[model samples]
Target: MRVLYCGDVVGRSGREVVIEKVPELRKSLKLDFVVVNGENAASGFGITEKITNSFYESGVDCIVLGNHSFDQKEIMNIMSSDKKLIRPVNYPEGTPGRGAAVFKTARGKSILIIQAMGRVFMDPLDDPFAAVDRLLNGNRLGSQHDFILVDLHAEATSEKMAMGHFCDGRASAVVGSHQHVPTADAMIFPGGTAYQTDAGMCGDYHSVIGMQKDEPLRRFTRKIPGGRFTPALGAATLCGILIETNDETGLATSIEPIRIGGHLKPTL
Candidate 1:
């Protein structure tokens, strides 16, 4: 199974780029499934139902959310009916949307997608490790799924890496989000799970992690909110990881970082 996990999509620019490129990329790459982080897909805040549907129309099989999942109040209601969208699993039991789901790819293969949040430098929530274990033991093992992808929406790189190692032999791939800066490390673990510390943001690379550089710079240097952060209008790069998993075991065989367009150098 070949899966493409895209990094966080920021604001209008990010969505526009995906809408423009993904269809062609899917056909040319022979992709089996595509998962995108939609935490910032609206206006660098939360996702909206319309934006989520737009992503689906653009060939995204599963949409993953992070800390900003509920930033848009309407999503609470939309999540109740939308099975294709997922929020963090570590939230309380009665959270609006599901944290994990089984989706059928365009080719009809079953794929399990999970979204998990990290504890370090994040909201105090339920144990993510425990949540993942429960989900796998209950929904994944016996299900005739051919591919499994985990979106570790986290702030800490160490925590994300730990999660990847914990699920090494169980999941096909573990990709991180939220940091917005793509990491260089993309490798398959000994247990066959593909892992990357951060998949980066599909936004303008010329700015500060997709936001206008001036605001963050001012906040850090002067310790004051001089202005609101805005999405950079420059060309955006779609950053992500591509993983090829074994058909029988659903474990990764190869993994590589994917960075295309914008200011960053292209990667395979």
Candidate 2:
């Protein structure tokens, strides 16, 4: 199984790049599945049904959410209905959407996608490790599912790497998001699981982490909020990781970083 996990999509530029590239990538790479983090898709706050549909139409198979999962109120209306959409698993019990789902590819192979949020310097959610363990316990890789991918939406690199190691040999890949900056470290773990500290944001890198520089700079240097942070409207760099998993073992055989357009140096 080959899967492409895109980083957080921020606002219009991010969405545009993803929409423009997913189809071409799916064909050129022979991708079986495409998952995108849409937490910041709605003007860098949250995702909406319309935007999610656009992504689906453009060849995205599933979409994941992070800390800002519910910034857009309308998400709740379609959360349960949209099986392709998932939120952080560690969220409270009553959260509308699910944290994990098993989706099949055109070849009828199962792929389990699980998402969890870390607590360190982040929302005081339930234990992410325990939350993910419960899901992995029942769905064994190479048995119940052909592949398993865990998206640890976290703030701390340590937390992300810990999750990767914790799920080693169990999941096909463990990738991080939310930092908005791509890390250089992309490698397969000793246990055969692919790992990356972060896949980076799919938005203009010229701004401060995909936001217009003025407000972030104001809050940083002046220590005051002049205005709300806005998404940078410049050309975006689509960032993500591509992983190919062994069919019989359900472990990653290769992992590669992907960066296209915008300011970051291109890689594939």
**Model 1 C-alpha lDDT per residue in residues 1-268, reported as the tens digit of each score:** 8888889999888888887878877887889988999999888999999999899999988899999999999898799799889999889978788998998776787889998999999999999999998777765532467887888888899999999999888888889999999998899999888999999999888898888899999999999998788888889999888899877788888998888899999886
TM-score of each: 0.96, 0.99
Q: After superposition, how far is residue 146 of candidate 2 from its true place, in Å?
A: 0.8
The C-alpha RMSD in Å for every predicted model, in order, reads 1.3, 0.5
RMSD of 2: 0.5
Please provide, for model 2 over 1-268, each residue's C-alpha lDDT reduced to its tens digit, 9 standing for 90 to 100: 9999999999999999999999999999999999999999999999999999999999999999999999999998999989999999999999899999999899999999999999999999999999999998989999899999999999999999999999999999999999999999999999999999999999999999999999999999989899899999999999999999999999999999999999999998
Model 2 is weakest, by summed lDDT over 10 consecutive residues, at: 218-227
List candidate 1 stretches off by more than 4 Å: 140-143
Instruction: Show the lowest summed lDDT stretch of 10 residues, model 1.
Output: 135-144
Error of 1 at 151 (Å): 1.2
